[model samples]
Target: MAADHTPLTRRQALAALTGAVLMPLADPAAGSVRHERHFLFGSPVDVMLRHAPESPGDAALASVMRGLQHIHAQWNAWKPGELGRINQAFREGRSARVTPALLATIRSAARLERASAGLFNPGIGGAVRAWGFHDDVMRDGARPAAATLAAWRDAAPSLAQIEMRGDRVASRNPRLQLDFGAYAKGVAIDRALDEFAARGQGDALVNLGGNLGAMGATGWQIGIRDPFGEGLLASLATQGREAVVTSGSYERFRMLDGERCTHILDPSIAAPAQGLVSVTVLHRSAALADAAATALLVAGPLRWREVAQRMGVTQVLAVGPDGRGIASGALAARLQFASRDWRGRIATV
Candidate 1:
């Protein structure tokens, strides 16, 4: 999920969490350790691996990053890519041919909409762009006007209306634009983990922006971003084969008409969702956690728990508009709340 806030890289967040940089891994030899950084999907993709220098870990990481680039090329919203072509086809009321991977992602997103009970909607790409989130070219003072936002918000039916058959996808709705930024990181991480495993990777941490996955390790620490202030609100341990992701309204935003506007648009109202400070979700599937976090962010205080349940998500922590820390029973059991009591008592969901 996109936010208007300046997102912290995993390294930055971990530094604040542990009073040092990143997770305390089973420190490999300096020559054997590899931490590669790259610009993928307009966000930082970080991979830390514990493999000997002479091994193929370097090449494996390179291949994984390249795979992510290829995926971004297909579905990225901003540039002239396969997703752009698909949007054009939708505009023309024609079917667009998609790779098996793209088709699968589209179908998966559609299922997410259903599974989340319409809480997750990729069809808001048009409204998101209108709100000036489609491009990171950063038009500082530019944002959609009330009228434009309304028009785009009402322009299309929900994602449930899109029709897909085999590898062909079609959308007759004029405002039906798809932006997979919310889950792309997690999907990429899953892909990377699959690649690493095939190449006999050792313990590793795959972090894309704030969406992270850890494998071949135990009790790795993660810090939940305190959306309201500095430092983290809590630290938690990750189970093997787990992914953690957080979404906040301020993560990606610009000042519109002298007002702070974020990328987390509400599909129902075609406006920015309010009242939620942040939402963090953890699950085994990075992709699912990514999308579910966004949905729960939009769900905010009242409906977040219900959405989490619908998504089969038992681990969640949410900051409400009132600045209270709310978490699911499962998450609360595992979380160690930071001593910053100013953030308030933990409220169970």
Candidate 2:
């Protein structure tokens, strides 16, 4: 429901403080692969190129990072950005003109909402904030009061409450806030891919906090994280230009008064999702894969197939709370798991 508003963990915070960029594979046999790194979009943003980091080709890498920063600036809800201004206007019962990118995002979000049967809602910001996810990491690691949760549910801020006309956007529900966390990373990834291609840097892998997009004939090798525990659950090699996006309930959670509540809230319940631990989607567009993976994650195991079909994504892997993974046939063909603990738990759907 929200966009890339990630909470800082000890590991990530330390890495950012130390300026450590993760480049898992830097094989010289492939080419002169240079990595350009930055901490953007609440996560590590990296670009691996087949050119020198200080060369002219690195402009694309720099451009991609700057573009992500620009999008983060506009789409960030917690900051005093363009989106916040629009939300403030809505709070005062007024309509306001938004940038073209924001408008396009709203329009596409509306389509995704219908496509996911309302499972992927950008209008759940109130409930998202109610659980104290409005900041970098949860400042108050306590669950929201029962009445506060009820109020947000009763209000039900959804796409139905939003109104988009020409360049202007507004909402009828004052309590409804927009969080693009579910969609913005993918959009930024897609934009970065396009930007890289435009800059003549075709062989590159851009990862924005594990929502990755690869643009090159060489393809890319990606590792899927275990949701219930640490380390990798599996690995997959991309087929041509492909992107891999994973949404896990365990990635970000708040320790709420002796309990752990995840960040992926079910729009139906206005609470954190349950049952499944992670969902990963493979597609050409990282944006679609990002949102689709989230929808499938929220849908859990029982209904993930239907949601995946609705999202037009055929290659997906949904991991259960027990560490077992069920993925599409296409995804199974590309996945390679070396974990001995994962053999009996994986099956092709």
Candidate 3:
């Protein structure tokens, strides 16, 4: 799920063949693991639960899937959902009422945007659309003109411009179109994990694409994919109640003017981010890990450590455009390289 970005069958097969395996229960007669895969947010959502035969695992899984659907209906920017309506309100210069959950997400994004010093902005939806990334299928041909990119860069839209009063929200900057593609999946996974915990099914894993969260007595083993190749770079075991997320240029990219353009847009340049090939962050909160991965990727190699420190993330792994990779000492300690030939260095930070 971290890379290859291939179809479901191949990706799942590769994960299984590699080291990203779920631990087997001690007593097969006592319990079984229920696994299901669904499509949401233009990506696959995989749910795994280990439960006793009489436990309501199926029911819990259904509830969690329904919750994810609700989230997609509310937050999907391309679809005619709550997010669409809010974008319409922004265009009309009017305030729109939002659900409590949506409000909380927006506020949390604002906080993270500030914490990352605008490196992880969600208010560049207009720029994202201009780059032809708003549609399920990317628009082909030439890239957006330099003038268009300059206009967006000059506008400098940010999530901080969004104003919220009770349930109503408005934006001071008309250019501030909200896009939570980088943040929503993690939040949804967190919610699903919470639901599993609430149902006394603490032994569960929710993986939305490559961003995932897990909880159990003995945690899950996750493989970090090589950014430049199909093989996995390393494997690590997660602790209880932890999320692992990776942001990379290897997936969700389009070829424009013979150049591969990624989906992650840097607000400062008003274009797809460059320099770093991928970044992975491990944290207790999936949302934070997701956002931090993007921020650190945009930060690139030189500034990623500073940004990670500012964001209070101790575990991080980043790979540059070249084959060079760096991991925070905290993360390096837990990583088990799949091969000794891996080109990774550890930093104390």
Candidate 4:
């Protein structure tokens, strides 16, 4: 089914512009938490970190930010860097040692792959490239040929074929090239939060393009983007000592053949997910929530409740393309849906 690619409303656009211009000036000395928004993982990222009462916390946060940036700088396939190393590994047809940090991430990726039954494979780089999502190759209404799709489909590595032995990871199939875009940003946030916490930061919230993680006793409020209405889908109001993450097909897309295509390519089908438009999850860790969002997207509505139950996720919310949504048992009980008088919206469940 074809979907519509909606641009941000004037208000939303203004908010984004305001955030971009004002975020860099946010310093810890302000005695309040600051929200910093940026583009990463080929998607938008927003981070909220509490200011440290002392100069040391400020310096620590700044250093943590720099480290996060470096991780993305080296590993972002959209640009160029350590991705070439992965490419090299593929060429060599052998396992490669990744940085301790990256190894932790890849190990998490492997675990998610096993959990999702291969639906969230990282070895879809060939398919992603062929689809022209890596570069601006889809410009001017470009679409890959059926033959190219066939080649990628044939070459893409199965999750089962990937081998991860701590700091080293390899693919049984030489054609398999890994792309962790689906979950890397969340992992980055997790790492950043960990680093900040280790430095004695009181409370911190890391939003790597949308995926978010928070540490400490202070709970954060998050506004869920509405799919068919004005403003937030709903706000999660709680002060949990955990992290929250959300993802949606509503962001990042290119039009082709009179069809709107999103950037969330399902490794199982080598195409973007169908039916669902947005999915959000709250959990103890950003990595799990982020990976779960993708897996739920691929699973669609059919297996959502079951998977969420199996994974022991705290909560989940999903909006279908038809403007209908369902919330998990946990979330339904926790969040207060928007009122119609104010937003002309209603929530069932």
Candidate 5:
């Protein structure tokens, strides 16, 4: 899920519980070891792997990191070869055969795009890059001009323009450059969790920069940060593995004319969302949760609860611009509202 803060836009949140069994095979050469590694993927990835005392977990950790390296090699847009491949297909005006892994991701993107009625469009790659969000290209005092935003939106495609055949995929709109920034972490976390499960690792937690998932029968307790406070607003003690995502206007933004603008743009208008400071959604899949949170971000306060209810998302918390907000009915059942004032909490069916 997303952090409840300003200035720290991309903070990761992992839902971890107590009493989960993490038994690693023992090794004679060393005591319990936790291997930590940092690598560059679509974005920066920080991975942590732990083993029992005296367990040979380094090798296994290395193997996991190697798999992640492969993922970056194919997915990293900055990589010359990968860029060339995508560019070449666009230049040729032909559909390129995307790897199964990539196709699966796009398929999920397509689903979210449709489900959210274009609110959560993956076709925002151009807009994202134009805003200098890719390759860590943050520009000082940089904001897209109205004309630039119009052009980018015009050039962007809906997910329908993307076609997947077998393992090969093609974009009908050559201008459509796919960016999984919103959902890749969920996919990566799922990948890592699968790897842990294959080795019979019990109760493992995989947190890819805050997109968290788990394996085995153990429940993971995740903290949902307080948007305006120092500690967690609430914690979820869940039995099954799920994807938790947050979209907050506080994450990435610039103060222009004494006003704050965030990175979560409205694709239809190509402008920053206004009102409703932030939103967090808990769902069964990371990709779904990621895309759904964006949808809610765009829906704003007036219609957020209505849309969320229609989508069957029971656990949603919105922090309002006036510091007055409401939690979803399902979420309210689990967590108490701090504000007892009649103005703060409003529930509608």
Candidate 6:
């Protein structure tokens, strides 16, 4: 499932209860850890800086927060932001001028969407809203009608149809409405790290909800949330610049007729994806890791490795609905499980 669009107090409470905490391991000798938490891109973000002087770290934190706010203002599709204006222009069959940063993001998203064979689409904002996923609160209700799904299927919106001429962007498919919910947090995290790096604060970590990136000589230990139940399923240590992102069915969902429906939509079916409970990917690029995790989850248990190979993501761990975990050999070698008898199989990718 995709990350929640906004911070939900209830969700936070649930996370606390379930032990789904994303925290850096404590090490006083590793230098003082300066940490801050903020809500951005509809999710809680945790910023941690290590081995930095107090003043510079604080300034760097402030800069990163401002940068994150700027990104939120430009890309938040639910609000009256640049993305909303762009969508309006699309509906009017006119081109919209975009900032260089946004244009770059659009280009990257389009490439990844094509690379994943359209499994990771940002051009399904219409479907997202029709299913009531755009709302801050996902209320339990009936699924979208057959006609609605059929219309969406017929439109077949894809980012590949977006044409960019200089800074102006127009879509051949008028039905296309861009929603970067799956991709923006990763971009923001990467940007936050960039801000820190610019300030000479390279030993830092940025965790936006579950999508996280870290860079440090001392490295970091990260906990992976259990998709099937409470507490963590495993942990991994990372050094240098790396991102670990997870897409899970438990993240954002609504009860429909006593059944839970996730927010991650399958472009082919124009419906909520199924099969995999969660998929985690480790990569150098947070944006790519975030998008790849979602795509792999949609690819499900049987075809996940195939899609992962196509995306050039070899380090992965996927959990199915049956509570069984599957890990790539590279990732499996690095993961430290909480229990000795954890049910999982390793695949060579």
lDDT of 1: 0.73
Q: Per-residue lDDT of 1-349 in model 1, one digit per residue for the tens?
A: 1111233344445474431112332322323457787767776667777653545877888887788789877778778889888888877888888888877787888888888877688877788777777877646785568898778756755667678888788877867888888877778878888888888875667777767887765445566766766566666667777888888886777787788877887777887788787888888888899899889888877788888889889988887767776777777777665553623456665
| lDDT, model 5, position 224 | 55
lDDT score of residue 21 within candidate 3: 21
Worst 10-residue lDDT window for candidate 3 reads: 18-27
| Candidate 1 regions with alpha-carbon error over 4 angstroms | 1-32, 51-53, 137-143, 340-344
Between 5 and 6, whose TM-score is larger? 6
- Model 4 is weakest, by summed lDDT over 10 consecutive residues, at 18-27
For candidate 6, lDDT tens digit of each residue in 66-181? 98889888898889989999999888899999999999999999999988989999998999988888998989998889899899889999988888999899986778999999
TM-score (C-alpha, index-matched) for candidate 5: 0.76
lDDT-based ranking: 6, 3, 2, 1, 4, 5
Assess candidate 2 and give its TM-score to the true structure: 0.90
Supply candidate 6's per-residue lDDT for 2: 16
Q: What tens digits encode model 5's per-residue C-alpha lDDT throughout 1-349?
A: 1222222112212122110111111223432336454645523354444343324345545666776677666665545545337645754678676767777777777877777767778777777666656645434565667788787777766768866677665666766766666666667766776675566554455555445555435455455555554434445544456656667776566654455667777778877777787777876666667777778888898877666765567778777777656666566455432223312343422
Give stretches of model 2 more than 4 Å off.
Answer: 1-24, 51-55
* Backbone clash total, candidate 6: 2
Model 4 reaches what TM-score against the true structure? 0.83
**lDDT computed for candidate 3:** 0.80
Q: What TM-score does each of the candidates earn?
A: 0.87, 0.90, 0.90, 0.83, 0.76, 0.92
- Report the number of the highest-TM-score candidate: 6
Please give the distance, in angstroms, between residue 293's alpha carbon in candidate 2 and its true position after superposition.
1.0
Question: Who is ahead in lDDT, 3 or 5?
Answer: 3
Candidate 2 clashing pairs, residues 3+ apart or interchain: 2-181, 2-182, 3-180, 3-181, 3-182, 4-181, 7-137, 186-287
Where does candidate 4 stray beyond 4 Å?
1-31, 34-47, 92-95, 136-140, 164-168, 341-349
- Residue 27 Cα positional deviation in candidate 3, in Å, after optimal superposition: 13
| Residue-level error in angstroms, candidate 3, position 43 | 1.3
- lDDT string for model 3 (1-349, tens) is 1222222233433654322222111234434678888888777778888763445888898999999999988898878889989988887889999999999999999999999999999898999988999988865578999998888888899887888999999986777788899999889988999999998889888888778898887677677776767766666777888998889987788889989899998888888898898898999999999999999998878788898988889999888876778777778777766554563333334
